[model samples]
Target: MKKIFICFALCLLAAFFKPASAQFSTNENIKDQPKWGLAGQKYVEYYYLPDIDTYYYVPGKQFIYQSGGYWTFSSRLSKANRSYDLRGGNKVVINEPGAYRYFAEHKSKYGSSSSNVAVQKSQTDKNIKRQDSEKTSG
Candidate 1:
């Protein structure tokens, strides 16, 4: 009985004790990110496009936008937004789940006209440049 109990405990520990690297690995999550996602980031769940007030779900590859006071999901943006440059526009990395639920908050924080938007864009740009330099130097 003692040996059996000890074996069971050992098995439980082995199952729950994941390696540190494995626990922190973002490779699997990063695979779902969009092509224009931020470089050197571990993983991103959504990209909030402040300029257009839209959220792009990375895993689902869907755009979440407002239409007639309702949240809509589509693979592409509406005709009105067709002229927007998604790749060139400022993108705020949002890791929160169901980010659209806080649309009002996001808008106030990262909206096109918000002062925070410029600061965030500049910070993001600096990080990207730093990462690029590190990659090249290494």
Candidate 2:
């Protein structure tokens, strides 16, 4: 009876601190995943354990991913390399896959901070006049 009591106590202790896989047994597929993005609360939590890779929602904290360190915004690149679109909310993607520090930079080439939609209208008036001249000559 004493041996049984001791065994039960040890089992309970192990259950409390064991990893997620040991704690739960389910038929879930979680390997060879591509991109991990934000869910509900905040930024995507890209982390690694012993043998596999996993991701979850962890806001106010950040992690960096290392495998394919670069997240692409260019359409010319392969689809798999694409980064998360940040135009919606305060969004970001880990260029690497571990823990990373982020810096905010704009994609706009215009001198002043202006709406990207207005870029077309801001075309150096020189270009517009050149186009008009070409049309008149032809």
Candidate 3:
């Protein structure tokens, strides 16, 4: 009886985890690199910078922008964007390989969704928590 119950439990657990395992397998081609994603996520193909209207392609480690009526892909931002600060800006992850090609059509859709507020709010929350903790510890 105990062995039968164990077998049933195992089957139930496998059933519950099967979908999750399969889902991860489908994304095996996507890489999980620290330098590629926002919020410290492991895998992301592109980063849409709404503030500056630019796209950062994570896979190639390049930034894509419009120049002379054509899309330019370069490792560094163009002269006009040299002053743009990446550390403080918000980033939206694009997982598709062809994400850059579709930039012209989807830039506005993703750009409008600002991640700055979330980043700022998180920073503020962290500061408040640190202050509270310091007050109690000291």
Candidate 4:
């Protein structure tokens, strides 16, 4: 009876404890990011394009936009945004997960006007430029 009770307790403890590998699940996306996109020390999860009210996921490399009143994910932007230049366009870095969930707040804060939007250079872009300058100077 004592041996059976000990075995049962051990099994219960094993069931309650998760594997060490599972603790790092949140960073699983980091492994799949493009080399250039991972240049900086900071990890960027998404980019909010206020100009068109779209969100770009860096890890999955997918564009999140509104279509038919629902959030749509696609690798390419719609035809209407084909002319938009991502490099030069205004971008707001959103490190939060599921950034689209706060669409109303983002829209209100960063309206259609460029002047109202607080544009920021992505960390990856900044680091790349820094490395390029260093190579030329060194």
Model number with the top TM-score: 1
**Colliding residue pairs in candidate 3:** none
Where does the lowest 10-residue lDDT sum fall in candidate 2? Answer: 129-138
**Could you give candidate 4's per-residue lDDT for residues 27-90 as a string of tens digits?**
3455655443323424567767778888888888998999998889999887689787666565
Q: Which ten residues in a row have the lowest lDDT in candidate 3?
A: 129-138
lDDT of 3 by residue, 1-138 (tens): 999999999999888784434434443324543342345344556677766777777667788888997888888888998887676665655555656677765566546654432121122224411111111110
Per-model CA lDDT versus the true structure: 0.69, 0.28, 0.59, 0.65
Answer with 1 or 4, whichever has the higher lDDT: 1
Off by over 4 Å in 1: 1-28, 113-138
**By TM-score, is 2 or 4 better?**
4
Q: How accurate is candidate 1 locally (lDDT)?
A: 0.69
Candidate 4 wrongly placed segments (more than 4 Å) = 1-41, 112-138
TM-score of every model? 0.62, 0.19, 0.55, 0.55
User: Cα RMSD for candidate 1?
Assistant: 8.2
Task: Give the per-residue Cα lDDT of candidate 2 at 65.
Answer: 33
Off by over 4 Å in 3: 1-37, 116-138
